[model samples]
Target: MSNSGWTSIAETNIGTVRKVNEDDFLDLPEAQLWCVADGMGGHAKGDVASQLITKTLSDLASNAPEELSVDSICDCIKQTNYTLIELSNQHNSIVGSTVVALFFTAEHAHLIWAGDSRIYRLRSNTLERVTRDHSQVEDMIDAGLISPEEAETHPKANVITRAVGAAVELDLDVKTLPLEDGDQFLLCSDGLNKVMNDLELEHALKTMDTKTISNRLIEIALNRKARDNVTVIVVRNEKQIEEALHETLPLDDTLPLHYSNKS
Candidate 1:
């Protein structure tokens, strides 16, 4: 468990010239979550599919089970997958979304991802990519067919090997990390990472709060001429520790007499 005080804000913007924005945010008291789902399968339905995935995830977060566990998180993802598939069938469209979600508590942060969306943690001014890309280019890089630099510009770089709604069952990649003061986590779609390098992303994150960081990252991606939908979530932990000693705390006088008497 964590005992840290933190402030978080998230925002999403449609690119300067895109007709539709397919990004969404889920900001709740217990957790701050966001996702960018770029729709595939062409036509205007792509935007609808991405929006459906985001809305479904937001709904799950709102009605999540009382206990927070890895199984619960996976169940939410699986449910969202089923919803997307049902929607696709109803609409008679081959639509899918790339999802990346972050869940942070006082003690630790959990990341769940599919497709090429990414998650990164910035600590001590160094940025680390915490999620692996489920894409063919990543596989080629892993197999030594291309260097990291070469893979970045590969023609098939945008081709993802897995995504929600692509099949009946989706395999979600989940990871957990210990929380630390002054640590920041970023979750974004390929739109941003595809255009910005780690160093550039670090610079942007260091310069702003969560909202600014989110917008500026999208701006950078657009400046680099990225064509896909972009979404970002920035979480910074300003951990605070406090200790208090009390002999007998006073009860609230405004409470009902029966309740106040127990206190």
Candidate 2:
């Protein structure tokens, strides 16, 4: 409820099944960046992997907020990937995480992700998924082997093909969009989306502000007995905050800063 620059709130829960909440997030509004990372299931020290991803970008953002941009964040994630691989080798187990980050610059919102974690943008009562999931089911859908609805309940729904520490080399996707008035963004792990569909999410984003949308999203997921670790981060482009920060660029002028399918 504070009138500030790009307000954000994050929530995480262990859910009804998992004993450990192997999910972590970064909510640094002052740096105009927020992220959600879900630890790889069936992997050891998953919580450690998720924490490391957030901590790595957090350190860079804290030390140099002005330098926080798409390139810098991607570099930090790649660096974290190497760190997690080393940690996994030392533990003799696979330790990895799925990361989705939202970085806000003066005129655009930059997004980067790997695995099934996602970022969604709601503008003018319409919802648009910003990042395509890097998962087995998603691939099936791409190949016309499965319908979107079937993919939801597919046995392999939880099987993600890409993650930070799973391979010697890391692959990440980057996208950018112009900032718009009343544009609200949702960053979450698969737990939230698995239980609630796009219609429910659109309803929440259309009617509520950032904080309310965040609480309500988690409340609904927990009510549905979210079986996996649940985490959500809701952010909005507040006009007052934008003016305070001097990012008064007209909407028409804001365009995708850069594009990369994978890196």
Candidate 3:
């Protein structure tokens, strides 16, 4: 990791044993945005839906509003839902996907999600999940019908309670957090969490760099014979805000006071 200007690197693999790739990733430079979408409608339509969502989001981030707020991101996702729904109707197919996105700016990060794709933050060797799953099993756990451990093995664990293109309207979950040096974030699909426990994921992320951790995590899921698509995006903050700008400054020019870059 370079200690200047939000220098982050991410690597993704399709996993050793998946016949169809229903996962898509978006890495945009302007806002340092990283996203993962896992499609779940069925067959070829699933891949198409995920790809469409990713492309829509990439476009929105590229031309994001001046005050890149959570509401703006939610609106972008809603627009994506409409696009997916329209495409599905045009092709006479049902298509939907779960999205997890992280928008990294100079000083903070914003997260948005729908369905089960998740985001986790790693700091001081500890990992904390940042997004809640919109699934039946999650609802059950929240309602106290079952413990978190039981939800892991529940047959309905794969069923999502909310998703893009599932209905006329979509509700997005969003959160924001401040960034710190050496902090790392992970965005992953259900395939990674379904088989690998939180402790295992934490250890893997803490010990490995972005590329190796991503590859090994996918390997673990494939070894467990995960039935769904798997994907992961890791972001590590390597420099302080001031240090980053100073490192990239032109020798005779003054740095811009407002470094509000959105993705």
Best model number under lDDT: 2
Among all windows of ten consecutive residues in candidate 2, which has the lowest summed lDDT? Answer: 254-263
Residue pairs in candidate 2 whose N, alpha carbon or C atoms collide under 3 angstroms: none
Q: Which ten residues in a row have the lowest lDDT in candidate 3?
A: 254-263
lDDT of candidates 1 onward, in order:
0.67, 0.83, 0.73
On residues 27-73, what C-alpha lDDT tens digit does candidate 2 reach at each position? 98888889899999798989999999999989999898778788899
Give the lDDT of residue 153 in candidate 2.
Answer: 79
lDDT of 2 at 70: 87
TM agreement with the true structure for every prediction: 0.80, 0.88, 0.81
TM-score of 1: 0.80
As a whole number from 0 to 100, the lDDT of residue 64 in candidate 3 is 62
Who is ahead in TM-score, 1 or 2?
2
lDDT of 1 at 74: 68
Tens-digit lDDT track for model 3 on 1-263?
Answer: 33245544444455555667888888764567788888884534788878888887777776764656567767878988998888768877668988888886567788888999998887767889989999999999999999988887789978998888877789888788887776778888887777766676666665554435566667656665666677877776544322322222231222223222111
Clash statistics: count for each candidate: 2, 0, 1
How much does each candidate deviate from the true structure in C-alpha RMSD? 14.2, 9.1, 10.8
Q: Lowest-lDDT window of 10 residues in candidate 1? A: 254-263
